[model samples]
Target: MMTVTDLDCLRGQRRVLSGVSFALDAGDCLILRGPNGAGKTTLLRTLAGLSPAPRGALSTAPEDLVYTGHLDAVKPQLTVAENLTFWQGIYQNAPQDTLNSFDLDELADRPAATLSAGQKRRLGLARLHVSGRKIWLLDEPTTALDADHVARFTDTLQAHCNGGGIAIISTHLDIALPQARTLNVADFAARQDRTADEEADPFLQGAY
Candidate 1:
């Protein structure tokens, strides 16, 4: 189980998050929603361990977290399969044909930079298949994805949750995540704004 105590974040002069608290047990999904600069990305980065914890709340085991952002985190030069291999080396060994399961078999040899946005996202999603980590942090996960890929992502996420994995996704899309709780960060932090240097909230500006 992963527990996030209170997360206090300051972006520049603004306090993006103050005493923000939430808990996610095993197999739970938390959907993060907010406006353009509601600190949604900042929170995701903190969860990813890519950004520093400012104050109050948020304690976690770094090894247990998995993060995927809008950038896809792919090596433009590496082929589809190579990227998976690299990730497998970092995470745990993946199940057989994990790429195939995501309908990426045909493009396994294609360079990640050459694929469309949706395909790249799938490759990023495939990492969860073998990551073995229980916590997931995804940002803008559904951007540029077609219906089929979205369905696949939802299915895999549901399976992961069923198997005791928890996920926190930041997206504008409204997919049917029955058990998922959608929280709007904008509602909580829209009253304030700040710069990264001021509060050192790097994730607020795609630090990771």
Candidate 2:
């Protein structure tokens, strides 16, 4: 089980969302819904420990979580198989059929830089299988995927949850994951009143 209570999210010292809270048990998925700049990414970054720890509690251990952001995180020069193998080595996990898992077997030897956008997205997501973590934090995971690949990814997500994993995703698309609940992040928007000092700082202007 994972629990977050009274969480606060920030973007470069500017508070964006506050009093965020949620809990999820094994085999659960939560979808974050909000418009651009509504702090969805900030919240995910905070939960993934990429940002400073906020004024709240996260019950899950750091080692149990894996985060995937907007970028695919692929190595351009590496072949598809090599990329998965590289992550498998980093996580020190036993070998997994990652290529087959994401339907990358046909292009296993292709360099990541040569693949289409959707193929690269698949390769990026395949890293999750190699990661062997219990919790997944994804941001707009289906960015470039076509219909068929989207269905494939949906099945993959279902399989993971069925195996007692947890997923929290932020997406504008309506992905029909069974029993998944949605959280509208706009509800937690923080009200900021900038002080004179803050207003005078050129670096702070137009910061997201």
Candidate 3:
């Protein structure tokens, strides 16, 4: 289980989130919906332990965490399999056959830089299957994916949740996600006494 207690976030001198709190149990898949600057990524970063501590408490299995952001975070020069192998050494220890689940076996020997944008998105997503983590934090996961890859991603997400894994995704495109918890940034801002676009920053790149 993942517990987030009264989390607060600061970007520069601005308070991005104040008294932000939530809990994620196994089987929980939360989707964050906000305008351009709603602080979704800030929240994700905080949850991933990459940001400054918030005002509240967070008690979770730190090691059981997997975070993938807008950036691919993969070595551009490395082969697909080599990249996976490197991440496996640091992030997971899944069976070798798990690569087949993502239909990446054929591309294993290919250089990561040579993959198409959609292919890279698929490659990024393939990490979730191999990762033995309990919690997944994804930001705009469908960034460069096409219809087929998106469908595959949705199925993969369903399987992960079915297997007791929790995921938090922030995206612009809406697809049917089973049993998901949707938190609107508009509502969040209203409660926080801010304007509609005030809290939704992801849509606006300069905010980041």
Error of 2 at 63 (Å): 0.6
Q: Per-prediction TM-score, please?
A: 0.85, 0.92, 0.85
lDDT of 2: 0.91
lDDT (0 to 1) per candidate: 0.80, 0.91, 0.78
> Clashing residue pairs in candidate 1, if any?
5-57, 5-58, 6-56, 6-57, 12-195, 12-198, 12-199
Please report how far candidate 3 places residue 34 from its true position, in Å.
Answer: 0.7
Name the Cα RMSD for model 3. 5.6
How large is the C-alpha RMSD of every model relative to the true structure? 6.0, 2.7, 5.6
Candidate 1, TM-score vs. the true structure? 0.85
Query: What tens-digit string does per-residue lDDT give for candidate 2 at 1-208?
Result: 9999988888998888889999999999999999998988998999999997558889999999999998999999999989988898998885457788789999999999999999999999998888999999999999999988989899999989999999999999887887799999999998888778889999989653
Tens-digit lDDT string for candidate 1 (29-114) = 89988778789988888778777767765567888888888787788899999999998898867678687778898998999989
Q: 1 or 2: which has the higher TM-score?
A: 2
User: What is the alpha-carbon lDDT of model 1 when measured against the actual structure?
Assistant: 0.80
Q: Give model 1's clash tally.
A: 7
